[model samples]
Target: MDQRTNRTFICSVLFIDIVECSTKPVEEQIWLKERFNALLSETIKDIAVNDRILLDTGDGAALGFLGDPEDALFVAMELRDSAMNDQRDPSLSLSIRMGINLGPVKLVKDINQQLNLIGDGINVAQRIMSFADPGKLLVSRSYYEVISCLSQEYAKLFSDEGLHADKHVRQHRIYAVGHYEFKKATIGVPVSRKTAPEPKEAPLTDQPQQGENRSIDTQASRYRKTITLLLATLPQRPFHKKWISAAIPLAILVVLFAAFALRGGKGTTENPSSPKVVTAVPRPKPSVTRVAPPDTKKTEPLRSTDPSISQPLSSKRVARIGFTLSAVERKGLDITLTVSLKNTAADARSVALYDNHYSWPKSHLTDKGGRSYEVQEVYFRKGGKRISMYDTGKTGIPINGGATVTAHLVFRKFPDSSREAVLNLHPFIYYGWRWTEHDVNFPDISLE
Candidate 1:
């Protein structure tokens, strides 16, 4: 291969790191890597051979996509979902954290002269993967921007995860692609049992195993005995062959006539019956009684003193959501958003404000100009002190039914020209087979 011609190109890089592979037994680790490679190949088989590259990273691997950036994004999610549905041994459970980034990279020959990817592209991708929760996918800002423009459906899968400070790179904006099933699988939640139930043994009497031949012989003997008895009961005298043949036709004709007689005939008309005199009965009309109308002057209008008591209940009595953009403050590139959410859901539920878990809920802000910003920092005020959502080890703000909670969401500042924005709450829900977008739009509010 010509080193110069094959060396470099701009492409999307997908770096996947197996979570805790070193902690597992060496045998188990080997099994996990084999399974991971098999799944990765099966999932991205549609991509052309020359357009993609897979380099084993010991615990995980790095995949390069020379085609559309969307393909890399798709393959990442597909691998996660497929791994979740994998029926491998539970002991060999494989969970991966994947990161996708698009940039220019150089391909070089290693000591073994094998093609290896080296550049800021793959390096940054590996760092991004480290930040991801196991079985989750994270993407760089560039990858997000490109894919979002290519397909809206694919765009909805990603939620902004604010600026992440890396050791090698300064603050980098990252977006997370939602994969709930993969998250559950990583936590060892068996969505479907891999091992099938054991087969039950059949009863000796019902099962036709050793005694099958004997049973058949017994049935044959009984049939033979029945035939012998019927033959004995039959007349012993021999009848003429001609008479027998003629009687068979006559019997068939008589039976056909009898069947027709009993069936009330196909085209035959019925005999006329005597006409009887008719009589008519009439129904009595309902009586209409006139009554005076009630006195309107003595009645008072019904009313309630509390406005909340008079407020009509929502038709959907399940989860009633109310959102408001309380305040917005900007300091340089950082913006703080105060949002108040009311949940009248039947149970005490947490609105996914932010979380460190791969499976946690997420919220984003979309400006009127169609630009979206992911929440960078999340905290709430309680007892006159700010409580960080991440430090509290809670995925979202907890609100009881018929109660409201407020949280402060921070994000990279919107463009200085942005005057209005919409807060997207619970933007995505993964249903295993497919995903659902349940973005609750908060009314547009002024940034001022």
Candidate 2:
């Protein structure tokens, strides 16, 4: 074990890391770095090996060892135990991943005069890292076999999930020793850092997989399940629409279908049984039918189509007005919306708002097309007088997620110049709560 060049024994390079390092925020870097450094120093000091700790790779540590595979397995297990039993701050606790490979290595001095180690040992160790779980350890067969010869301590290691030679050239056989049962966890986040060597692309084999595709499949499955559960408990109701606007579409379809059936696919050919012809049939009788000349109806311009420039250009842009409701007193309707402008743009463009207040859509709320809600009317006060020029149009605002944005709607009469009018709107709004809800926060709405 002396510092000599005569050593030619098979040595294993082991890599260890904490899983799910991405969840740790940049704000906690100081705390994480301290805990990780301390833990590594302590663990390495306790392990019986002539190994040298090469570097601190953020979430995990990299180390080079000059021992047989058996000793490497022992060191890896101890590292996992230390992490769990660590007496440090609970918030700073972490896990580790250990990789092992048997290869020749040589230690030398670097430009900074620090002891350095290199060879196939470190490479294989990183591969083992991909195979291990939070509290488990994985080792290569070369490692398992050689270490088992030295001692039967790690003979129970077995193959785990995928022969995990992931997309990064990091490949290996996995193992889960001890009473630890691997719990299925969604990879809700990703990890960062590992500057020693850039990750190389994994070599292709017989079976290849796209991890991202699996993730998408997982999300779709969750969405389907959520919909199923919601429908199971939700009340069933027929979908309706806004009056004549709704009936017109149905009427058009009915007419088209009727015409198709009557013509029998003859392409506008007349049918003797059609009402148009049947009613006029014994026509010898004085003609009682009256038909309008085609020119009698006035043509109209479509909201979108530009058949010709002869049609006058429209100057109407849909405009909306909304307001923010900060802290509303349910009793007095006294709210605090002192203009929460996060950051204004250089052009001073459309002012961004925190959120809008809306009365939750109810009876007056039209349940058109199976919507969970309807446009809720909202009101704001000016000079102690209630004004009702608001829109229930835009449903929810990007207020942290659940915030409501009542749009500017048709203005109607207010109760009186003395009394405040009640505007129908959804009350609950979410802000600054991204963890509880995604950033579905609606932008602040206004009547300005």
Candidate 3:
């Protein structure tokens, strides 16, 4: 064999780890460890060959790249999807927290003359991974800036993303990874140059998985399958709600036409313009209370005999979307709130749209009988102008009990202030599949 020589290169490094080891039987524990290591080794080897210009540092490897941040970023993201697929066990999940940095990397000769890497690029990539959440990847500002200059496609992607001031790292921006679900997007980033040929992007990230979802679409393939699965898996109770995709808008049109007809009483008598508040019916918010928590101390449903334990609610709700008070410790630009709704009204074809006001209702359970001890502090806005959602005392929707259905705000930002320890929910019914209302605020309640 020819003598191998150590080389120097700039590459992106990815770190894969086996986190949260379980205390199952020794055989079972060994099984998980072997599964992780085998998969991790294969992924690392693949990156070196195809995504060359990349590096791995064992549990996680920092990849160095000869290309711009765009190339490195793209490489890291693709690798992430690859790792996830190669490691098929979502429970006792085989995952990697990748960090990409565009810096100097070196391949030095080892005792057996194989190769080993060392440098700032390695250190920085490790740091970026440290700040990343599980199943997420992050990069340094320098990497981002480089990506911006290389491709406008990445620029637009980063600009629309929710960036976080690193939780532990000081003074740097770490964009959250959960925000990147390519499969859910109908229109994706246009990562092409005006003069150059476009590069091919990968398959959608929202691809189907086991457990209530699959790669194959069923007879009921909805555009918002992700949302459907999310709501299905989310902790929810049997609250009555109706699906209003068509009727709500019809109601609005009816009201608009009525106003026009009222003022068009040509000649015989002139129509007088006056406040219509007296005739306007007050509308209720399109709110959704999450399904009550799963009952403990009973035979847990959704049987899984894989020999692993159930994860806490955090992994379920916090990782994705759920009804949470503004007080949740959200990272990035701010927490993005998405409301999902259903309507169950019988008489009214659809529900009416109303002003959405946010309130935090504080409650604690002294006992498990379900009667929550609540200090429900309700209001929106801080300053001198206090906007109270409960001004009428009942801030809940009767929704005709069994007849009313539901809707929610999809593109909402966390209100400036959120009520502390509030339970239940408040969903805003809106016009688009995308619903979200920003700049809503909540303040701490005064305990008198």
Candidate 4:
């Protein structure tokens, strides 16, 4: 038996696919294949040939790296940069999407008795490749975690795209790797600099010198001293004396007015005992009208307690189903969501919910400002244990007729000001060798 056969080992798998390869002409396609193969060879020249296996996949290829996982990411980035710089034929310019995953894969012999690799790692890497846009790269959570520990510079290149839901794999976190050339291009525009004003030189003129200006200063000083002497000679009363002299006469007038008032009131008091006919004036009482108190019986707004009521209405019946966002909780940079899915069909044994092979379900939160928060992680909340989508040993949950399952999905946190967000669930269903994506829009839910 070969030493590389029937043995499982940890490695990184990189899957790449050319964008719109079928649309190109036969000659152009041949040129692109040659160009891309040469580019890949040049990119991985530093890596040992035995440590990496390049398998052609019709339009693109799958690279298996048994060495350090970071080497795979570095190669993918190099391939992207090299392809971008390839200006031989603009029409044959190759734009590819790449995905990387790190996991245990087994090396086995194919039907032709040739050594080949197959495992969940390769499948996941292919799925992640589907998530990336043309000229972009994406990596599975496992690959990201491995490279994160190996290289900080490599880890910083990835942005958290959040949890992605695939048909085979329910939900897994994926990260988008930043392209070096794109970053440089985005920051290439230089900032405008302000020009400083030119200093104006003094005009040469027959103006008075320092000695001439000193005479003017002396004359101004003499004039100011003369004005000060005049001000000193003028008669001015002290501030306290002026206030007291004005107050004495005002006080005397107030005392005389008070004496006259007292004298005038004495006559009315002395005549009061002679014949004061005391008349009692009756006070009018305020009228009191007794009114009925308002009805305090609190009427609760009619709300359905059934869990299905909160489920968003399905726009199109791709698989005869219903989905509802039960709860959404956000803490710092993490968001937790509980979604209820019910199978509405009675005759269908198993309904295909959604297909995430080519693309993930666009399950994301959109704020009023048009910012989107993509789903980051997904799991089945079964009792106390959380079943991850990447659990290869377990198959997808089967939903028979009238059966329902609660899916717990976690998304990247929205901005702080995003109090209310519209949750959009776009699921692509695979049918008849083609994919049909259904757009299910849920009403805006509160994030508070």
TM-score of each prediction: 0.42, 0.36, 0.36, 0.45
Candidate 4 local distance difference test against the native: 0.60
Residues 327-394, model 1: lDDT tens digits: 56666666666656566556555544553333444667777567777776777765466778766553
lDDT of 2 by residue, 397-430 (tens): 3322222222222222211221211222323222
lDDT of 2: 0.40
Clashing pairs in 1: none
Between candidates 1 and 4, name the one with more favorable TM-score.
4
lDDT digits (tens) for residues 22-128 of candidate 3: 43556656665676556545544533343343333434344444322344554455556655666455555555566666666666756765555677767666665
Name the runs in model 3 displaced over 4 angstroms: 1-8, 21-58, 66-71, 82-91, 159-171, 177-448
lDDT for predicted candidate 3 compared with the true structure = 0.38
Residues 342-436, model 4: lDDT tens digits: 66777422222222222445466677677777766666644455656544123444456676666665676468776656666654433222233
Cα shift from native, residue 240, model 1 (Å): 99
Q: Which ten residues in a row have the lowest lDDT in candidate 1?
A: 274-283
Reference-based lDDT, residue 151, model 2: 19
Error of 2 at 54 (Å): 3.8
Error of 4 at 105 (Å): 1.0
Give the number of colliding residue pairs in candidate 2: 31
The candidate 3 region of ten consecutive residues with least summed lDDT is 439-448
